[model samples]
Target: MVLKCSPIQLAHSVLLTLGIIWLTPVWAAQEIRVGAAHFPPYTVRPERGADTGLLSKLLNALNQLQSDYRFVLVPSSIPRRVRDFERGRVDMMMFENPAWGWQELSYTAVDMGLEDAEVFVARQNPDRAQRYFDDLSGKRLALFSGYHYAFAGFNSAPKFLTNTFSATLTYSHESNLLMVLRGRADIALMTRSNLIDIQRYDPKVKSQIMVSERVDQVYRHYALLRLDAPIKSQEFAQMLNNLRDSGQLRAIFGPYQIDVVAM
Candidate 1:
């Protein structure tokens, strides 16, 4: 056992070990946890089963395109997402905008080149004249509790909105729209794409509500990656672009009336 090992033997052993490590692929696939809220036509969490929506479709295509990373959804509410991101509960957020109160957060911003508009929805009463979105002064608005709207001066506080314009803020878009139909609220602001999807699936929604010619804002969407996220910002964009090139992007949104702003 006291015999000296030759330099060549030692070198071969080291090389063999290195080769084994190289072949073994020791690291697990990097997990990219995406923060998802119940934003219909984008991400919808169903009552009985798995979540389904546009964002869900996009993530599926992205997952199919690679093996280095596995994307998974991390459930979050509209108000709770920022805290989750800061606490590292989620690694990224899709279909986001900086103006949506995310300015102070530490994250990489990647322009998605996607656009969706939020418009006013009210019950169909052909006898009534067209109502504009410029004023919320006397309206009993059915607003989403955790959302920021351009017309509301980007305010999400129920009390402030209530004092300003008789608003009934709730979490569900369906509920908001229902309030409008049942004479509980004067109007509900919702995404144009969601309206299309809802109208297609539910004839009740189609027969009762009328989409306003008034729109609050056309969102130029983006992907926000936390500072500690596994993938680089540019790399995530590349994955998205790959989906764009493959016709998957348009396919997912085209039927819903959501057009891709970029390829």
Candidate 2:
């Protein structure tokens, strides 16, 4: 079985190997930092080895789809998002609404074709059933620290909210819901999506909470990108569209009891 190749044959084999390597596409991976707030179901601050949320799942899919761009989540808060974006500490903000105050900033908006709603949540008090959310006067409320609501005339100033409406400001939806559950607050304004997710994660919490019919606003979420971001709005939209067409979105959000809206 012993065989020897000529010098010319060996040279040809080496050249073929070099040609294949040269023709291979070698891409420089670009890092895309996506700002993340404490929006449950969409994003929860990632743990050491656990990426637990919708945004994490979506970002993982995006990373897998393209080798050129590596999407990542950067920590931020509702009040500090502007500072994060303006300082170039983060490249983009995900699942944002224009009304959240990025209008004056240099950024582009891309409609994500996903939506959620802000609604009122209260404790499951049988005695006060059907009479809890009837009036807003003289009622204690728990609300997110820096969110503008339709009922507040979209005024999210902490001083105005605490002084005018006597609202208790919380940094997290879980805290707001907990306040309502313990009767510490009359009602808490929360996202319908978050409520759904909380119920999914802890079924017992569902029995402790009751939701109201009064919806604050329906949110059509978007990705707000800086003007100097590595990716443009349209290009980002195209990548999302590819995910939608391939049914990846449904696979990711469906199990969480969320419906993927058509783009």
Candidate 3:
């Protein structure tokens, strides 16, 4: 006859199985996949062979913390990038200003300690440049796909353009600059820092670019992580905060001429 198992013995076996399942290595190793655009100086492709700008240094600092990170460069659009992140296709991304409507998606945002000034880049011709926004009253203005602008005092104007300006709006920082060079669009909106970075990578675009107006100032260059990421989002936020406190951020961005701002 077979011996009957005791209740305590059966309980011990159950606990052992549960413990093994909980202690599995797969539960411990987590990865974060970040999405970004080739908005040079802020973020760019490694194949470009130019400086990765502040984003590169920021990523390096994050890597130094030994965190697992994967980067994906989205083409010409931030809303698309956000869509990818929401679907769990990507774990995080960079440089999302708080104004973007993704705060509820459970992504943690960290201050990369950089500020950006928004400006309109128009043709150097006085009449043409002055008519940029005016002529676009019923037309489209090119803006970075997911960028936001406060418009300072022009918030009530009918033609105060931005990504949210209208469905007719078309945007591509590189393409927009190219358009200005070719006189295709009325105006292109961009950040001063980004313009400088783009010029550094492609000198040919420089002559066609000039700041038409300093529209608004905003804190730029922050890191974002999916709220449901396997690793704690708070931990990542804290790591960035520590980097800022220890001056590591300063050291990393100093060479790029970026100024850090607290969020």
The estimated TM-scores of all candidates read 0.87, 0.85, 0.64
RMSD in order of candidates: 4.3, 4.8, 7.8
CA lDDT, every model vs. true structure: 0.84, 0.84, 0.62
Candidate 1 vs candidate 3: which has greater TM-score?
1
TM-score of 3: 0.64
Q: 186, model 1: CA deviation in Å?
A: 0.9
lDDT of 1 at 101: 80
Positional deviation of 124 in candidate 1, in angstroms? 1.1
lDDT of 2: 0.84
**Tens digits of lDDT, candidate 3, 1-263:** 99887999999999999999888865333555656555556666533555465666676677776545533333334446767778887676777765566656776777656766676777666455444554345544566544555542324223444433542244457777767667666567776776777777787676655666545555576677777765565677777788888888778765455676684
TM-score of model 1 vs. true structure:
0.87
lDDT per residue as tens, model 2, 152-229: 988899999999888999888999888887879988998787888888778999788778887788778889899899
Per-residue error for 249 in candidate 3, Å, reads: 2.7
Best by TM-score: 1
**lDDT (Cα, tens digit) per residue for candidate 1, span 181-227:** 99999889888888788778887778787777778888888899988
RMSD of 2: 4.8
